[model samples]
Target: MISVDGLGPTDYERADAARLTRLPQHDLLVMAGARFGDLAPWRHPEYLRAVAGLPEEQALAALFVLGRQVPEGSLPAPLLALLSHAKIVSVGSGLLSADYALVRLEGLTLLAAWRAAGREVGSYAPWVGTDTSTLCRLVAARRTARTALDLGCGTGALAMTAARNGARALAVDINPECLAATTFNAALNGLADRVAVRQADMAALDLGERFDLVISNPPFLPLRRGALGWLAGEGGPDGLDFVWAIVRQLPELLTERGEALVQFASFGDQRGPFCAAQLADELPGLGLSARMLLKPPTPPRWPAFAERDEQGNLAGDLGREYRAYVQSIGATHYHPCVLSLRPGDGGLTIGRYS
Candidate 1:
């Protein structure tokens, strides 16, 4: 048996490295079926056959089979598991390359398909899909948003929601492909005129204007020493670096009474109250007040191909250690929070705790 510890240097690094290595290169065409949950052979025989033949360690065969069989409407728990190990690759008609990210739409695999056949074919993900719906509901409940900005607007999900709710909107991202996709999604949803898409970074935007509501689902994962694909997920060593940066810049981007909704994970050692409290403490210096609309704890789970460390513990223990570190910094639990902020409200308030 491969003791989990023997496979690891650490969970994040191990998972990150596995993702990098497992990604199919140019010559190899890995077929993705449905979502990662569609793993049953009945749903994807070809993929299952391919998996059966490859060496088990060289390829995580079970995931390849199960991911393709998962149901359409439900979140693919198995696929999410695979993501902890393999970088998702999207394959479909007229496309045969890897994608930076993957989402599913009506049983079809949707991807930010940047490069195809040595050419850049516009990026795309299901903009109006379930994920969009969930995000839209969150923004619509905010009554104070007269003007809204969607930072890192991959496919204009939040921007469309803002427009639908009567807010003048601007959608921003660093990827031109993402900007184009946002435009396409906006037009498809019949909200094109109300939402404007632009290429800009959250930290370096120059809109020359502030908003009553600013929402972002920024990249918040910690990247390994030399790895890069979608920087959206990596949040630096403690996973709060990007969130801290955004919080610091938010006051200047908001109207005096403006509020912003930002989604972030409390990952690694940065898991609890320390992360929230630190934000609370820092916001005052930036001249802002914050209200956390949602904060839900998420316990650590096993990742695909996860291994163990020399300490006879799962490699993911490093993440737990980091979580503990964050707790010591004042964090209390592993909660994902959506914070609403206004200018100069010295302390952070919890609007809803789940």
Candidate 2:
């Protein structure tokens, strides 16, 4: 377990670190999942059309990645120092071209950065997947909490964000790499003192602890092998194996007045569409209530969203593997759903976002 006590940067460091946060990093963050070239595995282009036209400092800051470089003597001395400060707190090694291999969330100056999620130990990068941006937003919408727990907190985005919202957060994951990433991100965002990193499997968690809020974005992909390996994204054949385990334990993990925002997925088998409604049915029996926040239905169509990337392009092998994976599990379709759960019973509301 990594300590949260007095874990933030020194007072002097914080003043310098604040300067680096003002750099142009959000454009890169928005384009994270997009691939720029036509080649297989797609290269993450450091220079975008939008970035190429900007001023020197602003352009370099926008498209910076593993090997991109900024012109020397361009930024102020204080800002350059802050850049080094950001890198010192970053973990793993895909090599960051940006001094910090991090990205800012919309409306938040604080960043969530990770090296490419790989098979290396202490190197679990949580690819901020398709629906996670929406999930993070939903998590942020919840009222403040004194203490929060982010179960399976890969790269600790939820926990880091929770800390930003003034909560003491515990980011727990089974992988050491993930815990390390969480620790790095917590420190990177100047919230080390407010976020603790721990290693714990969701099924085996028994810390004798409970939180006022909880958030999770578990691996719900059905593939057991290939891209969905043991390192980061791994859920059994149906993908719900991990989700079911977490959902069963949620009521016990939250406080009486607590609420939780969880991201979920349901795959359609020949048997039936195992959707949010099915999960909501299970929650009531545990003295909990669930409301579906975003579930795409008619018109917009959920399948299109699942098979495409941020740029509305098919993700080559990833898309193919996902479609085949679900078919292997007897599921022809899979759905994305986010739910807000709370202690005690309440009405179940299901919704769809366009």
Q: Give the per-residue lDDT digits (tens) of candidate 2, residues 1-354.
A: 222233346532643545445556444554454543211111344534434445644523442332344454455555444444434232235322442244555433333333331112222354444455676776676657888999888767788777778888998887765676577556556777898877888866787888998888887655453353455465655566667777788767988888887786677543334665567678778888877755542221223213467767447776676556555656555566676888877757666654
Clashes of each: 36, 4
TM-score of candidate 2 against the unseen true structure: 0.69
By how many angstroms RMSD does model 2 differ from the true structure?
Answer: 6.8
lDDT of 1 by residue, 190-249 (tens): 566788877677777678899988888765543331123343444654566667767788
Error of 2 at 212 (Å): 1.3
lDDT of each: 0.53, 0.59
Off by over 4 Å in 1: 1-134, 224-226, 267-271, 301-333, 351-354
Which candidate leads in lDDT? Answer: 2
- Best by the TM-score measure: 2
